[model samples]
Target chain A: MTCEDLDRRLSEGARAADLAAEPAVATHLARCPECARLMAWLLRGIGDVRVDSARASEIARTGLKPVRSLPPARTLIMSLAAIVAGVAGLHVVTMGADGWPLLSGSQAIVFAAFLAVTLALLAPAWLSSLRPGARQRVHPVAAVLLLAAGFPALAALLFPVRLAEGLAAEGVRCVAGGAMAAAMASGLLFLVTRRGYPLDWGRTGALLGAIGGLAAVAALQVSCPRHEAVHLALWHGLALILPVLAGFLAGRRAG
Target chain B: MASPEQDAVPPRTGAAGAREALDAELLRLMPRYQDADRAAADALVLTAGPVLARYFYSLTGDTRLVEDLVQECWLRIHRARQSYRRGEPVLPWLMAIARHTRVDQYRRWKRSSGRETGIDGLVRQPSSDPRPGIENSLQAREVVAVLHRLPDSQREVLTMMKTNDMSVEEVALATGVSQAAVKQKAFRAYQAIRKALGVSRREENER
Candidate 1:
């Protein structure tokens, strides 16, 4: 075979043994000794490379840090106690019906249906955007929603809404609004703190939407009053919490 | 005719000897410079710098650029220390990093510098006349044109084989492939080089 032809066979895995078996190649090898030597050189050459093991050891030596343990029991207990107090405050407001008529049959069912549909559409987009390195799977959106909804309702029980002439004597209105604001702030803090956590979009979104919806309901009960704690609990609470929850959830999952 | 003279000798089994020598050198270097091992490490890099610079020089036949490119490789290795997996053989990892850095540099050079440095000069012998031109420096080039032409896998396999003194089995183990597979890839790579250069593979059986 010509030089180019021999080159082709060599490139294509024509082993020396295989070439020897081929009458044409064998004949050529017998005539041209240089090609035979070159093959030996190539084969022998392949085994000469080595990685110095010590470098690996050196790299290992430099990188790892000790993982820290969690906080002490005293700190943990105090934190938990504070959280419980806040939650209790919110629950008290929601139990008070005051002058507002509690939704009995059809209205409750309609609200539930509306919530389910909104969640279905928003859930997938929120979940998919979770970052690769995130450790937690709890979606911030859901937490914020749940807080906004639950806080104001509880606050209403403790501080009932009252339609006053001006900002003064709007005791119930102020209390419920403060609770909703606090809940929303906590939810945002939770999300930011666990920035690397993977969000559970459906759960988070549903929780936020529920809170916002409940707030809307409470606001309607208070009427178009200038200073009703019930209205603040419902309208302002839902309005503030839902959109923030929705925005954060959307940004994370819409990737 | 010249091919027959070079083909007369068979491949000697010097790998055992070479590996022993390498281990001895490392062992000697480690104890003597234990306190200054980090310094020694820097020294090793400085020493090996030229080997690659020269190799690239041979491949590209660009005397002017080879030293600068080699320096770039060192900088990259220093910068990329965090990502590198520890407890692996240092030479292979270093070489791998060096290879990648060179490839990146080559890519950047090609884009910005245009096609001033062609792959064709890699195998060509440097001119004896040597008035200091790209063509004059070709003789000093390492003739890795065949390697350059091979697919990346083949090139990598060949590199591991040539530089690391790794057997096909070791290469397979290190790269997480089968020995037979490495052999097959290596063979294909060798074949590509031969075919491209229009060279006969007659002496391939000499070993």
Candidate 2:
């Protein structure tokens, strides 16, 4: 064969080697001197890799353990908390307009019953763990659905309709503050639970302090209720930011 | 410290370890399947386990992580086996999963830590240095250096050939290129290496 033809075949051999071709590409290879030399060189290049096959097998075998592959409970808790907080906030807003004064004596007792139901629904992480082998492997779909159902339920529970006349003068600030406080509490508990404890008292105290700051912001907004759309929008923006920051700080510290 | 005799003994111990691990894995896998499916999985793991590790080593750079990474990849493959077609290139499917796992590792590390860990760690192992007396290994290194000078397409083809030992037909299949096209790319791969290594025309012709 011509040099070009030989070079072409050598290239073919390289490609053939890559594909694990049948009949060894031997017939074509035997007649080709340049290809043979190239093959020798290539063979020399693919060196012996001293692999411990047994060790590899050991690792592969152990990989059958499906435990670690499961998603962390913390992620589930966070998801549920988000849903609960959003729904609870919505409920509180609606309640203020509807006039449910959650601060009153007998009304507080009724509100607490609703709150317990809401918490039962919203705290999916708790509900899921209650199921047999539930803590072991919670499917993503189930976790998501649990969050979806619980959030609105919690919101409905925390919706405080009746507020004091003074609090109304401050606008929906009390309702917003109450909703945010609940969110902060739930988020902090989730965070603490995720850290292998029921709840760390120190972390809770710290979170409470953070939530207090958020509540103060809510108090300030109520006293000077904004009239302009832009001002109300900013107030809403601050409302989301305050609890998120508190939860974030509380969660991070809990870990 | 253990004596040389004791150190040498672990390899034999390792074989027994393999068997024990196999039994344990079978216990886990068997409960998840019935009849032929269990038998098929058992045979597949016993037959393909070693080769897959070798493939993983070839695909990735860190020798230390190969064992864990390959094991994880296989677990994923086993879990997703219901989707696999029978009598297909099982190795290729497995390799694809391994590649995806490597990419995921890269992305996860990058996202979490904010830095690229380099492609070497992803595929070309660094646990063992290139063996002595392997002119091919030397050439392969030179080829890799030359490949970096080429475009990504050419480099990828070169990598598949050198690392995976895929024939031209296999390379073509993997890359969706024809056999002739694979040869053409292979020629360019060598040419780039030749040019970079400063080999003379006579020397190249002789080889």
Q: Point to the candidate with the largest lDDT.
A: 2
TM-score of each: 0.37, 0.37
Off by over 4 Å in 1: A1-34, A40-255, B1-15, B23-38, B54-61, B81-87, B113-153, B169-182, B196-207
Q: What's the interface RMS deviation of candidate 2?
A: 11.8
lDDT per residue as tens, model 2, B40-148: 4555566555544544444544445555666666655555443333333444444445555565566566778776666543444234454442122444444344445
The alpha-carbon deviation from the true structure for residue B198 of candidate 2, after best TM-score superposition, in angstroms, is 4.0
Clash counts for the predictions, in order: 48, 31
Give the per-residue Cα lDDT of candidate 2 at A78.
Answer: 62
What is the per-residue lDDT of model 1 for residues B55-81, given as tens digits with 9 covering 90 to 100? Answer: 444344344455455666555544434
